[model samples]
Target: MKRPQTVRSRGQRAGLDLDQIVETAQSFEVEDLTMQSLAKAMQVDRKALNYYVKDREALLTILAHKAFADEFSPDAIRAAEDWRDASRIYASSFVERALSLGKLSEHLWFGEPLTTWSLEANESLFARFFEAGFTDEAATRLVTMLSTLCLGHARDVIQATGSMEKPRPKALRAALERLNPEKFANLLRILDHGYDTYGDEQIDFSIDVFLVGAEAVLKRDLRR
Candidate 1:
């Protein structure tokens, strides 16, 4: 077997631009991507990709950073009218982006390399909460709660829709019908009304509930 020549520069190689690899990987579900596969798509040998990315983990980390930075941009949060608005915008955007990434959402949420950057971005958003009269403790707790809510909702959306693809209405209805009504009365009732899909409405509801609760707590604390 002949050895493949390494591309020395970060310019275009085999139709793959070094700069576009991360964005290209974002087009596929995280689990579906690998250096070998991506290189194949780029019409380059896998070794050629090494010139740009060291390995799969590094590639994934880059994608995670891009996704997080885009959604959690400090400027976007700063432009919000208030802490509540900032929280709403951040949570909604984060959930939607994560959901779009499918299995890759796990890497973004739990990956260790991105932790410092995540915390720094979140801290910027937390400052908005503090500026809105929330004590440090209150602001931290509220931001933590909102993050948990958004992550949980994103996970639910992934599982419900089966990997960011469109919902299989027939398959979903069949699964719901298989559950015993006696044990899952509420679920059955929900399915009966054709509310088989979890979507933006659920995300909005969770955010609204959290914001309302946070407001009540802040008001009570102010009164004390």
Candidate 2:
């Protein structure tokens, strides 16, 4: 009887592809993810990883871009009822997507030559803003400010809560207790209803405040 040829395992050697490496790497927590760690996960020698990706920087860049492209809708801005509503939708969606990445959010850098999906979303936003009477420069600044705010806010939340949903502030509450009641009375008062901490609601609060200021600016420009 003729026997079938022995098959080799995909993880047994350097017979690997970039997509395979990236897909496997995505399963690991960002902090624990490294070239060596990924290699270990694949059951291949670490050098095998280098053959596919030049180094860790190249690999991480690919990962960061992939994460953004996968999570965000390129037409999200166009789905809103109005230009102002678009800002709210985009800002809130951006923050939520970043938050969902957990510690991986820290590596979410948009390098030069942005992805097509990213550019598509920004283009929609710009068109919406222009139609709403904003100059190119004004629209650019508005988008930049809103995006910066969302990224910074998401980073702060991730650092404090480590992406824990509904995180309890046991440590923070205890630390607040140690402060002198006279000097920190107001701070302690928040502990009664629970510590006043970052949450998803801030996204709306920030966007609303931003829109108020933007409306003022637009009205002032029109009066000129």
Candidate 3:
């Protein structure tokens, strides 16, 4: 009786392993990179790759979480002390990483599992909020507000400058000076009331104001 030869696992097939897989996924082109291409790079059969990862979406989700964990894990921001410094560090680091990724973030935001991974990985943002002076409800709202601002501004910054740059203190201060928190709070209240209608330009303008207010509050609290 002739027995079939056993196929090696992806780890055995590729000298490079799961760590390599994660890194390869991050470094690979978000556009052209595919399951077949990843399988080739991994030196594994596509079917075998499918066994390890369900689909291209699954692979990207894994990669996104890995990349995010690598970038913003708690230890990564430990030097920032409590929530205030932590939040600023988060903003700066996120923008820096997003700038480095550029178009890849756009792909991830538009993609399935990747988008889920990105949003899920941001739970830490709320954790940081709680550590700061926010109650659970406030923390949730703050995290949502900050996430929208940060991600939207990140896209805008990349588009405007062709890359992400360090947020300028002077520039931030200048923008913050004109912010009307009462108006911004009212807008948020409107949003909470189920208003799905706002122009992108208005949202962006409001967010810029929010970011300034957030930073200002952080500074005041931390200084006290």
Candidate 4:
């Protein structure tokens, strides 16, 4: 049963703040969200939504930025054992949150006029690098490195999962299967299982391997 729509007067909407707008927007899927739908959901005129967001692209930019920012807690980050642990936590948070967004995660690297997802907004992450003895230059670079790794690998995981439903390369496997059906079958079976087994583990692998590589870079610099 559909409930009755609650229409508010112009005066009521005049008090509409970004927080209310953002909160209401969260109820929508990244694809189905629009000024008209958002307005309907809020039972306001579509112009009210457009007043807050000029267009769907602008709305997504704001929503994505807010979603990313809402994923972290400075206290949780501070509770890590060390910088590596902190990186792991942050990376996991980033990957998990981005994956939850499905298509919207791709906007992590994008920004527009009023976008607010900036490194300075999440200073806890940067402060972790500084506390771990990295110079300002290295710390900033590591932040970029982790962000790139998480975003790239998250995209990989998404593509791999989608490819699971796609046709497998049976022709390539057929030749291998003729020689050793057992090994080739096992090698390709992970994809048949939906390529989901290592999705979470892959995030950890990226962070751990990244930390090790970053440590080596620091040591190499010390020898300079």
Off by over 4 Å in 3: 1-20, 73-82, 107-128, 160-208, 211-224
* Global lDDT of each candidate: 0.73, 0.76, 0.58, 0.70
Candidate 2 lDDT, 1-224, residue by residue in tens? 99998775444356798789999988887767889999999888887777667677777766776786676775768978888988887887788888887667776766445355367667888889888888777888888888888888888788777444334466656677777778877656766666344776776678889999888877876677
91-179 per-residue lDDT for model 1 (tens digits): 97677767776666666655355465556557668888888788888887888788888888787777766444335555666777777
TM-scores of the models, in the order given: 0.63, 0.69, 0.53, 0.68
Kindly list the per-residue Cα lDDT of model 4 for residues 31-81, writing each as its tens digit. 788888887887777776665677787777787777766754566677878
Stretches of candidate 2 exceeding 4 Å from the true structure: 1-18, 39-54, 114-117, 162-197
Model 1 clash pairs are none
Model 1 misplacement above 4 A: 1-62, 110-113, 119-121, 162-184
Better of 2 and 3 by lDDT: 2
lDDT of 4 at 89: 80
Q: Each prediction's Cα RMSD?
A: 7.2, 7.6, 11.3, 8.8
lDDT by residue (tens digit), candidate 3, 34-110:
88898787676777665457788677667644554456544544555666556666666665566565665553343
